[model samples]
Target: MSIEVANDANAYLGMKTLDTPNSNNYVEYDGNGHLTIDVGEHDDFDGPDTQPGEGVNSDSFTWFDGMFQLCNQGKAEANISYELPDPPAERDIPGNWTAPGDGYDEQVVGFYYISEGGDDPGEEGDRIFVPEGDSVPLPVGECREMGVRTVTKGVDATTDAPLIDGDVVVTADSPAAGAPNGTDPS
Candidate 1:
């Protein structure tokens, strides 16, 4: 089990340069009821000191239930300090990445699809929130390319894993956020 953090201060940190590469990191749900992500940090437009706060770093238990279709990461009454993991060596941005949510004009740090109604509408396992504006329904897996900085970590099931360029298929029994007529799911 691992603890993750996504602080608000780090969501939107700076301007995306004209030549900047579109984020390749994303999350996906495998058609067989599993959501997997290639872990990494946000695009660091600002330096570490100016980046979002660190996450609590401590020993914790992390678990994912296939039956209930949930994923959890948290410390038992411990605060885990978090630091942005160093980006890959070849990228244009080379420091800890902050949240685009905090630095940019848009309220959404990234993009995601929320579940409208189902067995677990808001529950982590049953509901689905795609981080980068890819809209689809649950149980219907799709590859979405998106990114978001760590908002806050240490709390139970708060921050998701650092995702790299990869594929995920939503297999859990979750109803997509926008359904029928494009109404907000929350």
Candidate 2:
């Protein structure tokens, strides 16, 4: 997970791998929207790709949370958001995005936000939000572990990497603006 800067002038994100390098691999943020939680898979003998990445797991599709330690250095906190943008995307993946029929468990590939080590409250289409400035702990430089359940799944003959139907949105907003929060759109 990447630490977001709500007040860029004051806020900063910082981390170094956890003490256990073997299990907790640390990576510097590279502005690509994440850190320390990259995963991959390849056909055996054909390749594990050009590189055998760190923290190799038996299954390539699931990354259990606890891979992030975001240091909040600003007054505002960062909560993940999953609202689709306005005006829509010009070119989006084409497919039947809804259930093929009743009771069908349609494919799901997304960032499942974790709250207090339990199932995401957002799965029902409503999400939770911390009050203004509650996201960042007091005493600047204080670090908070942000846990996100990264889910990937295979859909019949679709791309080997699941085609993303939504975006992992992170944004900067104000505490008084009543943000770092979400409400049912309807």
Candidate 3:
């Protein structure tokens, strides 16, 4: 999986991992505040590079990409959006090609805001299994910590928790300080 973070300031941060077989892993966001986390796969290939009927011929291709925004602008909220692969039954399968199941299943993505200097997670400020494409508004206060996690359906919810967890200090915007006007004090 790959992870990228960006904001209005033009600052960018990113992380990625090589695709491993049958391994479940994820990236976390541990930054200051007001950043978006883009998660998905890149350049996934399923068929051989040879001519069709001469080599392996896959019937269909599929992939997923999405972005979740953690904003503290007017109100602390997490805006989530993602483009998931359509159902296999709905896709067009090419003739004279083998269409292997994409193995794409419904999963749950979660986001939360933790209290400053706190270790235990309470019932408050926790958005569990957030809708696939929706925004979750946070409580009325500064969020000092933020976390993200993904889990496959029908699995233990606590397993494979957030691999990325860190502090985040949301700061309100303010006007730039003006240069010292004519008066010289000392």
Candidate 4:
């Protein structure tokens, strides 16, 4: 499986870009039915530091970007697990500011499935709340196209700073035909 982080203009950090792996992006499911990817820190920024008592600078913002793909190598289906981090709050924002932080009330990390024709899967896609965790199922011999993103609630989709994102692919061998696929295959 291969994953590509979108290169949108708004998602770019001043001097710190996503430190994605140069190779080995594919995630294999272990016998325990779980796969984990550790996406390290936010990019390094070359911006002015705010001194004590100084207010928040408009340029000092958090940014987020992510995407993933699932490749089923086995004859059985499987589920992919991922957890989204909570949206930034007044306390989460890093700066010497006295004003309240612009909290993202309904922020979410969306996982969209793309059809063979490269069209959006629409309602069939998954949208998980930030700071929450969930999983999605993938069929055997199926290669699914998916796009992951972070956005604030109610407002248009925009990237934020101080964000970290990653993914994991899980599979179960010998899954009963037509049975549910995931970490808990009950």
What are the per-residue Cα lDDT tens digits for candidate 4 across 30-81?
4443433322322332234632221112323322222334455444655554
lDDT of 1: 0.28
Q: Write the per-residue lDDT of candidate 2 for residues 1-186, one digit (tens) a residue.
A: 765553322335443333333215322344543443344332232233565443322213443344445454544443323332231233222243322333443322233323442344444433233321223222344554443332122223233433332333444333422334322222
TM-score: which is higher, 1 or 3? 3
Q: Residue by residue across 42-93, what tens digits does model 1's lDDT show?
A: 4542334565323322223222111112221111111111123343343322
Q: What lDDT score goes with residue 5 in model 4? A: 46
Q: How do the residues 89-139 of candidate 3 rate in per-residue lDDT, one tens digit apiece?
A: 322222211222355343333443333333434455443333334333333
Root-mean-square deviation of candidate 4: 12.7
Best by lDDT: 4
- Rank the candidate models, highest lDDT first: 4, 2, 3, 1
Q: Between prediction 1 and prediction 2, which has the larger TM-score?
A: 2
Which predicted model would earn the best TM-score? 2
Stretches > 4 Å off in candidate 4: 1-67, 85-105, 108-110, 115-132, 152-161, 165-186
- Candidate no. 2 TM-score: 0.40
**Per-prediction TM-score:** 0.19, 0.40, 0.26, 0.36
Candidate 4 vs. true structure, TM-score: 0.36
Point out the worst 10-residue segment of candidate 3 by lDDT. 54-63
lDDT over C-alpha atoms for residue 110 of model 3: 40
